[model samples]
Target: MRTDFWKKTAAFGLQDDAVNILSNAADYKSQVLEQIAKAEQRIIITALYLEDDDAGREILAALHQASLTKPNLKITILVDYHRARRGRIGESKSEGNAKLYCEYNEKYNSNVKVFGVPIKAREIFGVLHLKGLVFDDILLYTGASINDVYVQQHDRYRLDRYFVLNQKGICDSIESFMNEIMLVSAATPRIDSRPIADYSEIKLAHKQLMRTLKKTKYKEPRASNKNQLSARMFLGFGRRGNDLNKLIKNLFDQTKEELVLYTPYFNFPAPLMRSLRKLLKHGKKVTIVVGDKTANDFYISPEKPFNTIGGLPYLYETILQKFLKSHNKYLEQGLLKVYIWKDNDNSFHLKGVCSDSKRHLLSGHNLNPRAWSLDIENGILLDDPNKTLEQRIEAEKVQILKHCIQINNYDELETMSDYPAPVQKILGKIKRVKGDIILKRFI
Candidate 1:
């Protein structure tokens, strides 16, 4: 009854469900391939970017092979158009993932269709940031795109959270959102066969589609008495009528006792920072698990050649150090706990928030200015009214914390002076030009 109050008051939308959290990227990839291989009806995947790497090629190959055998099986993948047409940052310019898509389509006879969804005209401003992979009646949700590092196809990996749901209602809802909103709109069909030399050529078409998608909302199915779990889907774009931004703040507002959060990036929106301070002022338990500088994807050690983006890890560390110093009182009182996740040379990219044992938000939302303002982001808010997912949630938290070390004080963080020469120099230049603020939203 108390939970129902927020559902009504804040206008939170929900659906009935059942879910299981995967431990790592390797497990996630295995489960995805297994599900796709066995799927009878349809398989739909939506992500930010499906890189043209070994893991990406392997997954694509499997889908292509399955399509040839099944004949009638529907396999579709939706990735960011701009991302597919461009090379990795600092890499030599080339045709990018689009070229690979063309080769794959030609080789497979176009059985597996990969559509490109452009949320904005270019990659910098915005792109399709949706996250989910649906195989028939099952949904595997994650922040990772199909890539070697993301899927852990090699020794190096980018750590991310994976969740699987096997409920018909939720699965159907996600499928419809892809079919009706994404596919039917401005999604570029047969992208594999096209030669996209420049995004500007299709800029107008993409803008129109972006407008249409912003007005669209996924109609969540009503929860019934027999349903085992309650969850809400939050989707946002552009700023107006952004349900996700409101819901995240509301979750923070509704926290009674303790709040735990996981984010790969240290940049928090001003409002969220204020909310965190409020939680501390009220003496509530707050735990934040973020990636250490070494675990940051942008981190380049002193041994490696420096890129401008390499300074981001140090910048984030600077932000974290500032926050910890400001909240030293809470840290001493044990009201605040900060853990930096680092598993040797592996990277970290986990993102979500949990308020007590009742409210769990499973999402790709980075909870930063960029996620709040630019990208098209979505999430599932699981309200465990009956505490049905308590054990699973605790287990997931334990696995994530396994390789992390708690920060006892602000002094423990690395200072700018201690950073590598390249990083320190780039950071100095960024500060001089006030480019750090500009980079915050894009990175």
Candidate 2:
């Protein structure tokens, strides 16, 4: 086979191929359900949160039905142990949904198993933040978790990117990694085996997890495809020790022309921020697309006074404004472009990056301090020699840009007064907020 053919095929270990980008949650749901309907042998899912909402229940129902029909099918789901047991920031605590899921697992599908990997103690400093679905040899990866808003069951929606790859080698490698870290680890305990309220048991579990992570080794198997995908997996506090940090550095150093970044928050690590600054100084084109203040948050009314829900958005705007002020020169020139998403209501939650229009990366890691220190993040990288892939990426950029308000010129940025009255009012409120928003780096 030709090198280009091998590169594209090596990622999914498949001959025929079709890559679809689901721009909206409804599209995402339709695609996912279609995939689920076709799955035969095995289905594995790992996500940050799997709520007990309409979308969540619908997915569960589908899985249950699949298991009933396919007697030989095997299904496994892994969700964050911490988030699964607790309530959302402003929501009431209820285990009713979890109980329902358990009942479904036991009564409906004996072939399907659900596991919750609690990282509270093991990830005391961060969060377990990996999201992907594997059906047979195909992998669908994105930053979205299982929830109503993320899948757009209701009117609310989350902005995200989705990639479907049929590379056998890549899929196998990732599947093996998941099995080793989450399924076969010495600390792999049943989600409902015992209550984690016991302090001594929690401590012991943490110790076991730490020990397993320290001893685990994730090696990249060698493949000989000239067009092989350039992808790497990153862990916050697991088998990989700062491997992600090194990989990121290598990617930045290899950039040639343009760099496109998508992050929900603007709080970048010192090293990454400094590296971006250096890239700008070298005259490279950098475009950052982020969720506008009101759009880039996760909060409900009952948690604060006046039932206001803009904490996350406000925090992001404040940091972004500061970063821009510090790099005014870059803004004055044509080196940097900042775009923020705006809708009548709702927040945005997506994270990924594209560099030089040749390299693309999709990950759950936000460009914030917490992602660096707290969340368990993973991504796939594609370095296409065939310019076709680059063209496709550029098209994606155009589509995303349509949903954003651009800030490429310093003069344009300074004219905040000229912005729509609502946007100006939001910015003003963020400026007056009291202390910095603080949380566990990974959560």
Candidate 3:
């Protein structure tokens, strides 16, 4: 049934020679810059945020220059509306990245367009988490947003997967979805304007836009060519009808030999966790790669004062310990394997799933409760029945695991009691009030 569904679904023909999986952030940044510089027809970039840092400025400047270099070039950037309008999380509210957009607009009389997409009326409930970049005929897909660390523009970096495919159909489909659906919707407004539209003004449109994005799939695609993999695009929204979430579980159930899953956070939604437990019970090899507490983006160094958010990594660790304790039998039997990824001061932000060395899901979906029910998400699933890309995928995994260490014991991770004084205080308070249970749903 799953095989029939995939075949019947409209998909793009992805030739082997046209696909390139990047290894590191630096190369991914370079590719973005180069593609922007030379783009002839169009460029569309979508992410949660496009920070106001050195790397962000550099990329924005490149886009402006590209517009000038080619009068016919059309460039568009879309980010979370609420996120783009607010300052740093803890800072007093003020005009945030949108201020920079306005300044750039006036300075260069910019031809490039920047749109703030409000996926929800409130940022707390949900935000636009979609991620993809299309430059002309090439599509660069990743989970990393534009920032100094994400692009490795500085000494510190946030690691994530990068997959580039030179497919015109895929690029066009993404581009059109933005232009026809997102741009036309009043909920998504041009942030480069003198004054941004107030949420009160677009309240009605916001509701309608959310309904459209949640239900719409990309345009139908051309069929796969001979000896090429079949690629399907999935728009993941609400829990009840989320095809991506359903497909992810199906991928787990269909794993004949082994299942490889990667998520920086260990907080899997209940459905995925159930599927994972079933895999272990059935004697299938289940391998999971997660980041150490220190590798969490919310982690604060010992030298720094701990904030409430800093306790999140410890919270994640506590969850990991609980899971490990329950599955110690699987660990002993060698059916379950867990790898902790840690690299210096850098953080890990990779998310995807691969089954039996045949099916691969390349996506930004975090595979958590928030991603399952809150944010707007999307993914590209590549079905390689002939295992054409197996060797390449294995090589990529090898490079990723170099900085990772496998752990067999739950005792290896830090317990809540082992956390710092400030972290312990806050986490203890949350646990006492049962806030921790509510907290896991959003984080």
* Runs with alpha carbons beyond 4 Å of true place in candidate 2: 1-18, 122-124, 192-202, 214-219, 228-240, 299-310, 408-443
Each model's lDDT:
0.82, 0.65, 0.88
Model 3, residue pairs in steric clash? none
Worst 10 residues of 3 by lDDT: 1-10
Q: Which segments of model 3 are wrong by more than 4 Å?
A: 1-5, 222-227
lDDT of 2 at 412: 41
Predicted candidate 3 versus true structure: per-residue lDDT over 1-443, tens digit per residue: 37444454577887877778899999989999989987899999999999888999999888988888898999999999999999976679789999988988888775899999987789988989888999999999999999999999999989999999888988889987988999999888899877799999999999999888778888866554554586888888887778778788888888889999999888988988998899999999999999899999999987896678888898998888999999999988889999999999999999999988878888888888999899989888888888888888898899899999988887877787787889889989999999989999988
Task: Rank by lDDT, highest first.
Answer: 3, 1, 2
What's model 2's lDDT at 419? 42
Candidate 2 lDDT score relative to the true structure: 0.65
* Tens-place lDDT digits, model 1, residues 1-443: 14343364222333333578899989988998999799888888899888899999899999988898898889999888878888999999988898888999888894788888777666778878888898988888888888999989999889899988775666777788887777775446557886543456666766777787677666666644344356667787867767777788878867889999999999998888999999899888999999998999888878878877788889988889999999998988899999999999999999999988888888888888878888898888777777788898899999999999998889988888888777878889999999988887776
Can you give the TM-score per candidate against the true fold? 0.94, 0.84, 0.97
Higher-scoring candidate on TM-score, 1 or 2: 1
Model 2: per-residue Cα lDDT at residue 121: 63
RMSD of 2: 5.3
Clashes of each: 0, 17, 0
